[model samples]
Target: MIRNKYVLYFFRIIVGGVFIWAGVLKIIDPLGFAQSIANYRLFPAWMAFFLALVIPWIELICGVLLILGLFPRTSALVLSLFLFAFIVLIWISILRGLDIDCGCFGSFSRRVDYTLILVDGILFGMSTILFLSSVRKKV
Candidate 1:
């Protein structure tokens, strides 16, 4: 865990910004995002459509709350869970020999790969750390 407040703030800003950008991109092209989700082939088409409709809003809200230091704990938890799921999904995609965009940045999404996992892993760590630090503050 990082003890420096500045370091934590940096993490917060970076993670929050990335999510906000990703959310906006997806919101701009939900159909495209839906297609990206479908590319995973793990979920039904209807589910992909539904997730495309809702997930970006969640990401946008959480990202804003995180950056504004409002509901930071909740925001961090949500983002951490999202990152965890993303990492798992990417790994599954790899094992299944599915090469497709990660749907992380909407049209700008990169292909699911080990590097994506590493990036998400780092963000997950930062989000988790923020969650823990917030918990500590409340104790």
Candidate 2:
């Protein structure tokens, strides 16, 4: 676990800021994000539409909570879960040979590739560490 508060805060801010930025971008152009999601072909169009409507708000709220240091554990866990899901989705997309944007930053998203996996993996690790350290403090 991270024993240094500064290190923990750094991770929190970096992760939280990234999510906040991504969320805002998605919120700005939900139709574009929805289109990106549909490009994946993993889910039905209706499901993609619903997810586009809801996921950005979830990201924004959790990111704000994280940066505020309120319910840090819960926020970290939620973000970590999202990262895990994203990792899985990316892997599946790669396996299916679907060349599409990740839909991570709405219109600014990058192509779904190994590099994206690496980036998301790092974020997942950071969020997991935050979750664990926060849990440790509670005990």
Candidate 3:
């Protein structure tokens, strides 16, 4: 748990910026993002498409709220949960030997691999720190 205000702000900026960028790219191509999600083979086509249409909007809103310092705790908690799910998905893909794009940054996403897992882990840590800071403030 990081209590340093500056550090938490830094995490907020990095996490928020990443989400906003990813969301914008997904917003540019819903079908493309849906295809990326489908490549994982974890979801049916309809569910993948639905997630594509909805998840990016959540990411964008949470990112904006995180950076704007409005409902930071809720934003950070949500992002943390989101990242956790991503980590799980990536792990499953790896275990199943599925070679697919992460669908993280839309078209810019890399293959689902250990490196990507590490990156998501770092982002998760950042969100955790941000969430902890927010909790500390409230208590």
Candidate of highest TM-score: 1
Q: Between candidates 1 and 3, which one is better according to lDDT?
A: 1
The regions of model 3 sitting more than 4 angstroms off are none
- What would the per-residue lDDT of candidate 2 be over residues 25-54, giving only the tens digit for each residue? 999999998998899897899999999999
Would you list the C-alpha lDDT of every candidate in the order shown?
0.96, 0.94, 0.93
Error of 3 at 21 (Å): 0.5
lDDT of 1 by residue, 1-139 (tens): 6779999999999999999999999999999999999999999999999999999999999999999999999999999999999999999999999989999998788999999999999999999999999999898
- Clashing pairs in model 3? none
TM-score of each: 0.98, 0.98, 0.97
The lDDT of model 3 is: 0.93
Q: How would you order the candidates by lDDT, starting with the best? A: 1, 2, 3
Query: What TM value does model 3 have?
Result: 0.97
Better of 2 and 3 by lDDT: 2
Query: What residue pairs clash in candidate 2, if any at all?
Result: none
- The ten-residue window of minimal lDDT in model 3 covers 1-10
